[model samples]
Target: MPDLLGRKFTANEPNRVYVGDMYLPACDRGGKNMYLATVIDAYSRKLAGYALADHMRVSLVIDALAHAHGVRGSLDGAIFHSDRGSVYTSQAFRNYCSSLGVRQPMGAVGTSADNALAESFNAL
Candidate 1:
């Protein structure tokens, strides 16, 4: 759908809302670089889930979401907000979210402000 997170930085409950993003580590080891995918709860500002891997593939994001699902027990009707990255826009990730009864909301292209919370989290 649209930018569900929009500019509002609050959620009514914990597991019902989350923001996700992928970032590159600062220290590159010269070899294959690693990426970090993080999902944070909007209500409590708690890290719902995260995954680090050698690739920024769609599976990385799926794994992070799965981790969040595992920790939260359920993500039914949860809104997963993220930027318009290919990994987030892939059909596989979309199907995965649908299977878990999660709603995938994407931010505008090239607009970091659309996903400010997740971006801010990545900064830290």
Candidate 2:
């Protein structure tokens, strides 16, 4: 997969680009785990949108993207970067991105540095 971000996390304009990732709690109590999907602006380092759910399904990611789209008001030609997670690679998510004119960019598999910003955000 090509890196649409070009390993550049900074952008001149907002809403034109973003990076996203999913974060799960360190421990799961009672066999229950909560997932947080977040989209952040590359230029401002501001959180565009986020969603929390008990599952890490595709819908969780979709909802996060939807929320980002909603908050941004428009995402046409926006570049969304993420890791090679199944939810981000699912056909449904691809279709959703296509329908919204958002470009999905994936970094190298198993390379956390490719998506450092999102990982950094998750660390916080």
Candidate 3:
């Protein structure tokens, strides 16, 4: 299992932000258009990674996590936080988090403040 993520910012630009974007192609699944979402890191502002797929399933999130983990090893039980979405709640993501030994944390339902970090980064 991987460790947690560190809160320390080593780069000079500690306030910098990184952005990632997901674009789902046209596909028919459950009679709904697929969706995409990105997760970015603040500080060392860079497009760390992204994920795009036919559906906004939990697997996509796990794929993103794999990409991130591949680039940066071991989160050291760091806080893996996200909005309270169904995909985030899916077993795949949960299992992936468990395997990585990362703590899964979520914001309150319908509360923007909980995901302020992600939203703030997106706004930037």
Candidate 4:
């Protein structure tokens, strides 16, 4: 609920901070849409987890975070930053973060600066 990271997208150690975002990869067929949610460890500068689905629901991000948990074992005392998207702000997501002992900070609306890292990752 707060700007915890304050645009400082760096972590001194792994699992301290994670940035995530969703993007739609180009599809040649164009019959169906696919969305990808990714989680990157800021300290390691590596992809910690990701999920691909035909929808951009809260589950997409949840799955990605879950994958991070699975890979990292525990997400307690970690900070997860993202844009003010509906899925990120949904109650389901908030509850998921709480269950994992993670703090979720969302950037201001209409500005990508606060979520630059994840936005850039999605662009790439």
Models ranked on lDDT: 4, 1, 2, 3
The parts of candidate 4 lying over 4 Å away from their true place are 28-30
- Where in model 2 is the C-alpha error above 4 Å? 26-31
lDDT of 3 by residue, 9-124 (tens): 22344212222334455556778776556656545544455666667677787777677767666655545666677877778778877897766766667765656656555554
Give per-residue lDDT, candidate 1, residue 65: 95
lDDT of each: 0.91, 0.91, 0.58, 0.92
Error of 2 at 110 (Å): 0.4
| Candidate number of the best lDDT | 4
As for lDDT, the candidate ahead, 1 or 4, is 4
The collision pairs in model 2 are none
Candidate 2 at 37: error in angstroms? 0.4
Q: Candidate 2's residue-wise lDDT over 99-118, tens digit each?
A: 89999999999999999999
- Regions of model 3 farther than 4 Å from truth: 1-34, 43-45
TM-score of structure candidate 3: 0.65
Question: Candidate 4's residue-wise lDDT over 20-70, tens digit each?
Answer: 999998852357789999999999878999999889899999999999999
Q: TM-score, each model? A: 0.95, 0.93, 0.65, 0.95
Better of 2 and 3 by lDDT: 2
- Give Cα distance to truth, residue 50, candidate 1, Å: 0.8
1 or 3, greater by lDDT: 1
